[model samples]
Target chain A: MAETGTSAARSDAWGVWGGNPPRNRGRQPGELETDQLTIAGEQLPSRLILGTGGATSHAALEAAIRASGTGLVTVALRRLDPGAPSLLDVVERCGVRVLPNTAGCYTATEAVRLAHLAREAFDTAWVKLEVIGDEETLLPDAVELVTAAERLVEDGFTVLPYTTDDPIIAQRLADAGCAAVMPLGAPIGSGLGIRNPHNIALIRQKVTVPVILDAGIGTASDAALAMELGCDGVLLASAVTRAEHPARMAEAMRLAVDAGRLAHAAGRIPRRLYATASSPTGGLPW
Target chain B: MQLVVNAVTADVDDAATIADVVRDLAGIAEPRGVAVALNGAVVPKASWAETRPADGDTIDVLTAVQGG
Candidate 1:
């Protein structure tokens, strides 16, 4: 953890190779599934959470989400029109759980109001509470973030703050009683990929609740990297929705998330600056 | 001008405020995710109250889209 004030953008320099995720062998020699990622005390089935706001068309958005196979998806209460491609109809048909978001809010008061509104609209307390401090950066206002989290918790809302990967900020958000605290791998909508795996790893290690890596993902590799770093889940949208082939990309994301989780459990080798021999025992064995 | 209001256009006064522009063009009760831009530059969300529009300004006011 390098502490505060990190570079805003994280370019993908990480090395990764992909394969079908390893199967979890239970004690009885049967496969076990890692289901229901619990954040802030709420259990959700899908690791690949989708966003409902950005597709070119309603049908397109619905197709991408269905292809993604997401059990938990996000929708906002404010921007939703009761008419015009209504979310309720799509959400009903998709048959996935909903996690409403509080976007465009700059103050705790407004954020809190939106959470209640989302709860009323979707009948779910889970929310992605984003209280932005800077319009250019879209960074979470840590001060207002905690303030709003505290309020939401009091009202029994599952508050998830979209925050930077600052340990202090993470600590504060978790302490404020957020269901889970989501730290960006990089700036939202930048398509820059994960910038600081170290910071995200640190946040995961420190937080008692699940630490979800949300936003700034460009491809499946980024999602895998987050899982390998021990993040409980991933919240994504553009990586699939914006893809030339969203359905295929959605399936790819699902595999990547599973692969990353299995690899974490499989135990990774320590990283070294220089190449090391994997086997010193190899000496022309006949 | 074949203007686009919420991606659809209307014939309204060129000097309308952003609030007026949206209220007139959108016909929707509330304008959400509507980030106003003049041609390319993003107008601050806070400034929608005081900012006025002019003809040929090429306004691009987009709603808060969630996904890609």
Candidate 2:
């Protein structure tokens, strides 16, 4: 059932998504065994990485995280209100590996400074480097992001670069020693769902590290679609925690990722624009 | 006593809180959006009201970060 509703949703990019000329004759008999989720050198069980932001409130965020069953959670280190909800308390309660992000830095130097401070505070080199080129789409500045990733990697930080789903760019990040390459499915906050599944496929095909389908996931189906497309993981926030039923959506997303993983291993039939009858006919010899 | 806060080793009364240290710094006039860490661990925002600074304890005040 993983590809049942999933194909309908991901049909937008079919021309590109499934257009890859056959590489492997067919999947191996057993399920595809992907490398464990390890950033820098730490191992994580859950491939579906969830973000703890944009929720209605701290309470909602906490519930959604619990529902999602995510072992790695994203936290932003920034100036909060004098009496606003405390990030420390929230992250602590989530009890997940903290991934601090360099979300708004315009330049590599700024990103490095924040990465250092975050490393000092969180005591982890797992930093999400988001150097956006354009503010409107929140797209990654490939040039700046690559520059920052190089520096952070040199400094011993497991830089996770959030970038477009371009194979060449994703390969660059992997070569730069990024623990993982998070190629956005679309824009940062658009929630338009997976806009370019093929690009994500290409990124997955090239990168040796984890390839996370990040951003623009609008609903549970969208997350499932990513996994079915062969991505090792999914990174999203608004789709699950901001929906009318956040907890329900969180549960759905959790299942979606798992189901999709199994499906990818199961191997899907080659998709065709024209449907053909499955039953074999003997040319009506009778 | 004149003290250099967050810049150099400084001096203050025995019971001075982190707020007092930031406010008492020589040139730092504003103390908003600043998180104080006594020694290394962060002092909880709520506990800051009642917590007091001690001698020889390194106090680091970090500014607010703005990112989306």
Scored by CA lDDT, what does every candidate get? 0.71, 0.72
Kindly provide the TM-score of model 1 when superposed on the true structure, using C-alpha atoms: 0.71
DockQ metric for all predictions? 0.10, 0.13
Q: lDDT for model 2, on a 0 to 1 scale?
A: 0.72
Task: Pick the DockQ winner.
Answer: 2
Regions of candidate 2 where Cα sits further than 4 Å from its true position? A1-36, A279-286, B1-68
Q: State how far residue A13 of model 2 sits from its true place (Å).
A: 36
- The native-contact fractions of the candidates, in order shown, are 0.18, 0.10
Model 2 Cα lDDT, one tens digit per residue, A1-286:
0112235444554332223222234655333235355666677767778876677767666666766767787766663344454555755777877777887788887787777767755677788898878788788888989999999999998888888888999999999999899999889768898888888888888989988888999887888899998888888887866777665577678778876887887899998999889888668778
Two-chain DockQ for model 1: 0.10
lDDT agreement of model 1 with the native: 0.71
Clashes of each: 8, 1
Which candidate's lDDT is highest?
Answer: 2
State residue A187's C-alpha deviation in candidate 1, in Å: 0.8
lDDT (tens digit, per residue) of candidate 2 on B25-53: 42344443345566656665556657776
